[model samples]
Target: MLKSMTGFGSATQEANGLTVTAEVKTLNSKFLDIYCRLPRVYSDKEVELRNLLTQRLERGKVELSLNVTRLTDIRPGVTVNRPLVEAYVNDLRNTSQSLLLDVSDSDLFKLALQQPNAFNSEVSTASETAASDWEHIQLTALEAIRKCDEFRQQEGHGLESKFREYIQIIADRLTLIEVQDVKRIPAVRERVRNLVTELMGSDEFDQNRFEQELIYYIEKFDISEEKVRLKNHLSYFLEVLAAEEANGKKLNFIAQEIGREINTIGSKANDASIQRLVVQMKDELEKIKEQTLNVI
Candidate 1:
């Protein structure tokens, strides 16, 4: 039931000659982030719209946009602030006369206020609903968002399966190391015996001192503790992955722990087989770590 933090949704509604629509898309993020683009008149609805999005989403960088059209008996129209335009024209003419400038007939003032935003009128229609009956539009938008979440779930399931596969590979490699390390301790003991015998040749090296030094040297090279801790970390990582939420950061931390233990084991293990297993485990772990960066 895990979900990724990336998705897309869009919905449209038409009510009594009023059409409104909403679209949302998201990307993975450590926290819940929202950006909205709404029409100027409906700017007041921003808080309510954000609340609706937060209800369904827990974490991600989300972008939302709203589009509205009026489809009533009324027709789209434009209005111009004639008084402002005339005032600018009169002021410019007076300035030109006072300065004695030989300028041509000017079209600057007329051209300045011609755009939709400069003196544009608000949308109005036979529909009484705000921004073309947005109630149904809100519902449609929510449904689209739900579908988006479903897709995220499907994708997250695939990632979960891949995680299990790589972790299993690492576990199998660890098992190989465990089996081959049995002879390593015996080999170290024999080498210690040989070195002591050579050093004491007719010189009478102390047996007690030699035994103590041998114990210290073998224990220092032992990777039993590292192996046990590494196994425990690997188990914890799998458990975290199964949780029903966005655990990307938590999973990354667990992977770090696993890597630390693996490196420690690699450095301490003196046997060729153990070293080979360590390399294999590291390769698998690195792959898992790379894939985890894309997880939500």
Candidate 2:
């Protein structure tokens, strides 16, 4: 089975008065590249989360975001620094007195709270609660990855079908080339004979020499080997596509080989009809190459 590198997945779970949502989106890339957005409290887990993504996804430009929201009425743990607030208020009162301006108590208190570290966030004391929350986040992330894989699998099916179609079209063109090739050789021989006779201005061309020259010329244009190699490459491509493991890079390499054979055949075809078929093969191969980028 083949897999596509493009996919999207997301999961959400609520536990311990916290709602965690994980989202993962991926696009085709030659290597694994991960970008993560984690809440500040969970920032320390970024490396672990990255490793998890690497283990699951072999290759892609991956974007992962984790959103932690407090669902309950209770806010995150925070406590006011009473001493800091009192000092700030004293400073504000002195400044107001010097400026001969009146300051409301509520306004002073609000301004004091806006200063840095005016409040401290209390770390959770319950180890089990923290552990459970982390576990929930991990599970949510794994579920998102699982869904992404499923998306890739579904897209892979479509890609497989497209590949089969393109390969078949190229195969059909190769068949047409073979049909035209049969007529090409004899026609080329006759044309060469006529041209030689015309140049000599008589039917005095040496039979032995002419035969030798014709044999060499025909050998140069012989695409039999190229045709066979191309067929084999095409067949091998289909075989790899049907394999159990994902092999996008291998398939790309095979596509290059297939292109090489097609180009060789085109350069040596010599026949207009065969050249046209070669052009069609090139077009189909280009499509295959484009689609192969999304394969895994």
Candidate 3:
């Protein structure tokens, strides 16, 4: 079965006063392009995380984010800058006195806390703790990637159904052309005979020469070879669609062959009904091409 390049998944794990959340989103792309955002403590592991994502997702523009939050007061990493807070509070008091204004202590404290450097959160760098935390993050990330694959699989099923529908439509159109093709040769012969008679008069027109030229002209418009080739290409396209591996590029190449045959038939059709059928086939093929871009 095929996979789609568009999907999203997220997972969160909590342990040892740390809550880690992993999120992954993907969009269609010709190659694997991964972008990551991780907490400062895990910055060194960014390359490992990227490798994990690349291994799971073959092709797409992938955006991954990891968020970590501390939940235990006993292990709090954040500390208030007492000297900075006191300076802010004292400055606010002096300004209030100079302006002859009254400010509550609670208000002054709140304003002081909002200043830059009032508090700082220390990033944990202990090798043992980092290793354990990385394991938790890795498991969470893998879970998110698994969910992403599940989503892609679901979308792939939908794409496969659509491809079958479009292929069927094109096949039906070819059948219609086959039926209409029978009347085409005779109509061309008769039209050529009438034109020759009208231009040179029946007595002047050479029957033997006209017959030879007519055969040549009609052969130029013969779509028998094109029809057979198009049918074969369509069948091959469906065969590849059911393969075990994702062959989006291979399918695209097959679609191009289908289009080449369709274009040849259209150019040589010289009949209104066949031309219309060719147009419809082109429409269906265009839809398939558009959807194939999302396949993996």
Candidate 4:
């Protein structure tokens, strides 16, 4: 089944009093590009997480974020700077006196606590919390990635439907071109005959030579070969679309070939009706090209 490069997924897991939330999003890109936002404690796991995502997502611009919340009051060492707090209290009291405002001691203490560097929470050098929560976090991340892949598959189905619809439209236009082509030849033959008679200014011209020239002229404008090749290309495009592999790039190349054939037929047709059909076909092919870029 085909997959699209655009999708989003999120998963949450809790273990050892730590709640981990993982979110992943992807967008269309020519190559795999990964960006991660991880909590400071889990920073060391960035490389491993990137590898895992790369293996699963294949190609796209991928963004991942992990947020960790402690669910329990128990934590590592944390300390209050008593001297800093005293300094903040003194500064606040002096400011209050200068402004002739009376500030309560409780309010001063609260304001001092809100100051930067008022307290320090020490992170363990061994990353004990990160190590303990790694397993649960990994599982949550993997589940999110799995959901993202499912989202991609769903998007892919929609894209496939559109591609098939556009291809069918192009095929129908080709049919119109074929029908018009049949009538075009005889009309062209008559016009050429009239023009030749007018130029010679006589009805008694070399019949055999005129026949040869007319045949050459009609053959030059014949679109039969392009029509056949275009039909085959349309069939091949559907075949590739049905395949299980993700062939977005391959499909794009085939669309380009289809465009080339359509352009050739339009230029050689010399018929306004056939040219109109070619224009319609080109429009459908352009839609296919646009959707193929998002395929994976």
Backbone clashes for every candidate come to: 0, 0, 0, 0
- Sorting all predicted structures by TM-score, with the top scorer first, yields 2, 3, 4, 1
Any residue pairs clashing in model 4, and if so which?
none
Index of the highest-lDDT prediction: 4
> Tens digit of lDDT per residue, candidate 3, span 61-162?
999999988687544467788999999999999999999999998899999999999996666635466677778889999999988988999999999999
As a whole number from 0 to 100, the lDDT of residue 61 in candidate 2 is 94
lDDT string, candidate 2, 1-296, tens digits: 89999999999988778888999999999899999999999999999999999999889999999998877665456789899989998999889989999889899899999998899767774555677889999999999999998999999999999999999999999999999989998987787778667646756767787777778777778999999999999999999999998578999999999999999998888888888899999999999899889886
Evaluate all candidate structures by whole-model CA lDDT and list the values in order: 0.77, 0.89, 0.89, 0.90
User: Model 1 segments beyond 4 Å from truth?
Assistant: 74-128, 196-212
lDDT of 1 at 242: 79
> TM-scores of the models, in the given order?
0.72, 0.78, 0.76, 0.76
Model 4 C-alpha lDDT per residue in residues 91-114, reported as the tens digit of each score = 999999999999999999999999
In terms of lDDT, model 4 sits at 0.90
Two-way TM-score contest, 1 vs 3, winner? 3
What tens digits encode model 1's per-residue C-alpha lDDT throughout 1-296?
55667778777777767677778888877778999899887788888888988888667898888887877665445566677766666776778788997554456465545533456564464243454466766776687677767766787788888888989998998888888778787887787778777867847788887788778777777888888988898899888887766477788888899999888878877777888888998898888777676566
